[model samples]
Target: MTNTADHGRVRDSYDVVAQEYRDRIGGELAHKPVDRALLGAVVEAAAGGPVADLGCGPGHVAGWLTAHGAEVVGIDLSPAMVEIARREHPGAEFREGDLLRLPATDGEFAAAVALYSVIHLDPAELAPAFTELRRVLRPSGSLLVSFHIGTEVRRLDEWWGHEVDVDFHFLQPDVVAGLLTGAGFTVEARLEREPLPEEAETRRCYLLARRD
Candidate 1:
């Protein structure tokens, strides 16, 4: 899908599901201890720099970033989510924006993150998304992405019996790393973890990369 159309569809989906998304998604499971650990490790490795929480639904990750002392901005395609994020996390900044078309300038970010966000984009579309990510990042900028570790497209299905049409294109770790490399990001660390019982899936990964 073209970026414009893809973004529009994403906005529509999120907006259509906003209330249910917020009500049904998230918890100790959604925001897990492992996330804290991963963030701690990344922050320590960050050496103090700003981070952009791309596709940051309801600003949960942005809240975590603020608590951890990282300058952060949470951007999402849905204005409703942004509003909720701002209302819930009063101090944090939440913007209505598309990840594939960032409003940030080049070298403005020290790091970019998409926690369980990129799965919405298929592999063919990843290069451009990664390219857009590369555009806003400073040279050697850190990129951390997390997603369900799997093969094949997890098509629109009844997620928790909601019957919502959500598209997920899961990739093996190697393919993700390759996309980062292809986008001029050097892989710093790549990890796979078994999901907690409460999670939708038992396997996910964190890929830490540096723009070259």
Candidate 2:
């Protein structure tokens, strides 16, 4: 697989710290069975049908979708993660691509999911990303996303123990809902709860949006 060097940068970042990421966020973000059940519900609810795990890293959700008989593709910015995904989950299609420029036709998906994926993108960056998600989702498609919500913006001074250059952005519930609405995703479900981390003062927000 030819790696776009730009894609290579993401690959390197993840490669440099893959184990660290897996350790830190992996357990905290572990929702394999529960996520599968919820995602299945979203797929069954959508008239267009099928679903995608947007920004799918290591292809966990994509693997579950495949097992559940959904036409699924896992997309991620990191080529290393993509490689690992393809290796680990042979049946699922794992592509190295940006969320902003999704490689799909308009209304191509019945659902789009991003679990703790947008934590790396700021509001400005996320607006266009949401636009892509909305663009590909069928009219009745739903988007379920989770992110670390906070009152203050946390610049990514580092990621998973690596001194990374990328900036990470956290959002409050209102701002996230506004972005979803602006991007043509009808905000249907929004929930806030305390994060699992003891030091985490912020809440974990879940948004379920459908195309309008």
Candidate 3:
């Protein structure tokens, strides 16, 4: 079961930093060629079907996907984030929702992307989160998930000069892959890469899976 208190903290913290976070991180994909390539692959695999951008912050990824010819719906935990996403990326849809209990119908999305979003969930919450993701995706639909690669939980008491409480959980690639498998997904591709120079120093992992 997911901790509701922790979810509240995360939602409030993100609401506090929504605009600042958008201004600083909105243009990240431009410098990331690999990320662009993978996103393009997702767009192609979606095959003109709607793609859900799970935990989409500021709608940048969803905007990028929209620009690349994919229908997108961006979901975030923070209402402020959703507002900013709607204002900034008018081309795509944005909604406030939780990962553990998404506001989506079963098999609704043809493909989904959860970039650096699951890092907020506790270890025990991960399996349920993945299961929820699987529940929304159509059979054979693709899922791309990215996270920091490690076994540490970094908590932030303050961010961007604002009082906030949130935790970022690093996870092992193998462990995440196994959890996806347990959630009825077939692991397809796993990629690990060092962070870009302008980004944080943490190594990152990306897993591509297919709903079975």
Candidate 4:
């Protein structure tokens, strides 16, 4: 499911294209109303405690949380991405860390968000990542996860004219819910939406849950 090879590939791929990716996607929320609304709700549920934005690419979402009155820390697998995040959001904490083995102790965060962060993982690896997410949150802490909805792993050979190795795994919403349930999370809401004009055509899903 999760191998060091794939993880290294992901980190290296992102490192190679961090700047272009940041320039392209940093303003994405401005055109995504649904995402902004859901993220606002997540911040509110977090209630001012430290929130972990797992796989927080470039720290845009973490910046949004900070703008909305939440204390946030952004984590990513790519050091280049983390550097960009730190430059973009000086007020928020940014660190390089893996989702399967976060650099935090148990019950370290009050809430967590993983927006399309698990897309690189195979289905078998998702449980371990979810368990790691649970391990970092306090009891009853909230979690908001989003992902592409479908059954496909889009293997991207090149991005922005740069060669890269990455696979994006799209999952069914119900399957994701089952994964959360098995990881000791209580599913509170399931949301799905069609993509915007600037986005991929695939449907997107959001799941709000709480640690049990």
Q: Candidate 2's residue-wise lDDT over 1-212, tens digit each?
A: 22245344454566666556644544432544445566776757654366778777777678766767777878888776777778867987877777777777788788888887877664567788888888888887889988877755654436756765444457777888898899887888876666444335666778888888
Task: Please write out the lDDT profile of model 1 over residues 60-178, one tens digit for every residue.
Answer: 77877778888787888888888878877676677887767787878888887888888887567888889899998888788889988778676664544544556777778898899
- Give the clashing residue pairs of candidate 2, or none: none
Better of 1 and 3 by lDDT: 3
Full candidate order by TM-score, most accurate first:
3, 4, 1, 2
What are the RMSD figures for all models against the true structure?
2.2, 4.1, 0.7, 1.0
lDDT, model 1, position 147: 86
Model 2, CA-based lDDT: 0.71
Candidate 2 all-Cα RMSD:
4.1
Each model's lDDT = 0.78, 0.71, 0.95, 0.92
Q: On TM-score, who's better, 2 or 4? A: 4
- Ten-residue stretch with the least lDDT total in model 3: 1-10
Clashing pairs in 4: none
The residue ranges of model 2 lying beyond 4 angstroms of the native Cα positions read: 1-12, 19-37, 46-48, 155-163, 197-202
Candidate 1 accuracy as lDDT: 0.78
- Estimated TM-score per prediction? 0.89, 0.81, 0.99, 0.98
